[model samples]
Target: MSSPQDPYQPGQPGQAPPQPPLPPQQLPGNSGRAFPAPAGTYPEAGPFGLPGQHPPAKNRRKLWIILAGIGGVLLLVVLGIVILINVAGSATNQARGLADGFTKMVIGGQSSQAYDEYLDPALKEQLSKEAFIAGVDTLEMDESCKPTYNDLQVSTDNGVKAADVAGVITCGGKEVDLAYRFEGTEDLKMTNIKLRPKA
Candidate 1:
């Protein structure tokens, strides 16, 4: 008649031994990633909340917008330069056309009209109308001198000011080179003219 020995004691094993502390109780409705894990849980709280988290997504978007704006500005600048070059080229071509038309008129014996219409205003001031008529008459007297179109070249020195046109006129099997400069905004006007006989 002695007190019953504890059944769970090592040598008195008649009752079932305790099952491994019930395998660490998991919090209900949690994926076991909950912060401050439940009491007697296996996982412990790890990292704490950081103050003022960065908006990485928003920052990335802003950076892209800035880059796009810069690119757009550069593109517009390039386009402006191209447009300016085209405009200058057009002006040069127009100047060459004017020179070609004037040369044709003079060679076809319409010297009077050429002298009156194509001469620069400054040149007209230097020579009287009578002198121009006399000079044209002298040129036309060369019956053997057959004038023909040779070549035309156009160039631009100052895009804002004027265009330079070079024209070659073949006469009597020889070449006569001339330079014409044009100025003005909407309607370009002849500003100067120079003639040279090519040997």
Candidate 2:
């Protein structure tokens, strides 16, 4: 018989004694929870518990909206510039047309119409219309009164109301001086005109 202290000596035992089963693992706070493997693949979390890459689409859309707004502003600026240029060009053309018409009327012996168109309202009020027409008609008859105009140079300062015009006129084979003052509009009315015989 085996001694009590030697429960089953290796040499005398028919088989090894059975071992005790291990205790179950305990999770920290939540006892029922199961831990995943450290290297396992899982969805990533981003700021505010949102998916990491989900906001890219929204960010892209916002960027496009901003770009479109910038483009619209640029388009408006370009359109405004175009409008300003066209208005300036139109004003210049109108001044030139008035100059050309005045030259034609004076040179073609249409003194009544020319005087009516060329004189400022104040000047016309000072000189009777009939008297002004008669004077221009007589002047047109003078062999020394043949008038020719050079290119019209038009400019503006404060607006269409403050335009200036200057050009050369040849009368009686002699170059004369001509100038216009815009009064409340760009309709260049003749302000000062003078003629002198060629030296």
Write one digit per residue (lDDT tens) for candidate 1, span 1-199: 2245634565443555566533323555556644553465444333443434444597789999999999999999999999988976776568767877766776667777887777767777887768766655554434344434344444544554566666566666666666677775556666776555665
Candidate 1 local distance difference test against the native? 0.64
Clashing pairs in 1: none
The digit string of per-residue lDDT tens for model 2 on 109-195 reads 676787777767776777776875665554434434434445444566576444455665556445545555545454556654443
lDDT of each structure? 0.64, 0.61
What's the CA RMSD of model 1 in angstroms? Answer: 7.2
- Cα miss at 131, model 1 (Å)? 2.8
Q: Candidate 2, residue 56: CA error in Å? A: 1.6
lDDT of 1 at 34: 43
